[model samples]
Target: MHRLPPYRLRRSARAKYLRLLIRPEGIEVVAPDGLPESTVLAFVRQHSGWAQAKLAELQARLAKLRQGQAERFPAEGGSVPLEGRETPLFIEETGGSRIRVSLEDRGLRLILPRACGAERDRYVRDALFGWMKRRLPGRVAECVQRHGPQHGLYPRQLRIKSMRTRWGSCGPANDVNLNWLLGLAPPSVLEYVVVHELCHIRHRNHSRDFWELVSAHLPDWRQERQWLKTHGGGLIQRFDPVFP
Candidate 1:
């Protein structure tokens, strides 16, 4: 009723029905090609009530993720969610200007030079981002090993980085690109995404066959998928250190 929250209308030739995807930033309406704009507009307006409620919940979740930035990074009591649990951060001063970052079983460790206090936060962010980049490829390989053999599916190459719109994508050649921010999510969530992309290598679209393939490998994938739909946006919007 209130003019509907912000929305972007995407016309997809492959889209069979109008779909509404709600995220923290706004709404995404995927409409079949050649559909009338008026029809799309009406469809969105029809779901205004549901969309509003979903958006409110997402906004609140993101706000909680942003609380006490000091407790998130580059300060005392810093923590981050890793593998579905809050992982604490610890920093130790080294004698040189270089920063050393490593992931221990206990938590993330940052070795920063005492003289770099003026720019510690920036340096820590960069180091942690690098660690994220390094962390994802190994995980993807592990997922492929666990799920790819029987199906004979493997990626041409794996490219990991911080992506804004999607968690992962499979190229025509089956080279996979994954968003590093996914590392912050639960391990199951990450595997679901990896499996989703791997399926794309065989079936380019979201056909029944593709979904069957996914279900064959991950029977509980629907739960992880739902988790991403509900919490993934906040991971990208509020918890991505590069953006923060």
Candidate 2:
């Protein structure tokens, strides 16, 4: 008889019988009543090596993900990838209580309060992101006023969300939600995103009507869209905003 990989078995009253499920995490075994001890032991004996190999693969992938997360931010005197090159961040102590981030002398400058410590990195990151969050609503409102009337589309409500995967989203109810991270992109990209969401007010899906609406307000919207798509990973990766 052909051998199968070793797997754990869990008893569930709701289960009809023995079941197998394969997932990215691993394979699972479920039995309604119970599996015989001899059968379980035999299964393990038959494919112990395969099980061990699968377990090792999963652990390696997890280790890589954890390592990537830690290395997301560069160390002092180290550089982080920005645009197409590695850009260095110059940290300085300033008298101001609030932290500020600005581009200076071909490098990114982070001016932190004099009271800074190990916690200062998270604090400054939040401070800069908070500024973006605070300004997003007004920027959306302005975009609505400028483009809404022209397209005969208006948002019932505008909101900001800390979404992980999108620049903005529109609802069937005409509500608009913009990703707080959009503020990190260049100004034109932000405008393109705003217009994109407002266009959803008229067309919910990415249909011809939607593209037409987006083009009507922003003729060069496609270029900006491409720029953001290619460069957006840097925006979220740059801050690694610590959520409280």
Candidate 3:
């Protein structure tokens, strides 16, 4: 039998089955309480190849994250993504309680309190999200209006919220819920998620019919989806602290 490498083990009362997680720090095993240590070791050995591959992937992702951390937000001259393009963020003190933001010459200018302290990042994040909330509905509505008629699907209600694990969801009564995080993705990626959820109105599940409908409208949706899968984590990591 192959000896299992050293790994952290956690027992969970609510866990129904054993699970392995590869993290930046190391591999962690989560098992139900009272699971025998020998069984855990056997499971680790059974999936050693998968565990090794996942560990390497985690290392690569951590390296990318460390590189990305150098690019912080709300600095004197930082950059923020707007519709997938990197636009310059300019901060100017206006000596007022109100924070104002504007777009000019392909850049974003923020007019904010001159004496903003530690809360400045929070203020900027809130203001930017406010702007996105006000603007995203219209953008989503436009995408729906453009594509809904073709697929014979229209949502009765569209709701936007901050989500942790999903980009969008389709619910009863033809309601579609979109994550505010979509604003951070490229416009094409956001459209893909919108079309994806809208297709659910026709086919309730991720069945062949649902994907066919999505493909009929956006042929290059796979590329957009892949882009989200690869780059979306950074956006979420960057803003999660603000939202949390």
lDDT of each candidate versus the true structure: 0.83, 0.71, 0.83
Q: lDDT tens string, model 1, 128-210?
A: 67888887788878999998896998999999876778899999889899988788889999999999998998899999999
Give the TM-scores of the predictions, in the order they appear.
0.65, 0.55, 0.67
Error of 2 at 30 (Å): 56
Q: lDDT per residue, candidate 3, 31-53, as tens digits?
A: 99999999998898888788988
Model 1 — TM-score against the truth? 0.65
Clashing pairs in 2: none
Residue pair clashes in candidate 3: none
Lowest lDDT 10-mer window, candidate 2?
75-84
Q: After superposition, which runs of candidate 2 have C-alpha atoms over 4 Å from their true positions?
A: 1-116, 241-244
Per-residue lDDT tens digits for candidate 2, residues 163-185, read 77788888889888887767666
Preferred candidate (lDDT higher): 1 or 2: 1
The C-alpha RMSD in Å for every predicted model, in order, reads 17.9, 11.5, 13.6
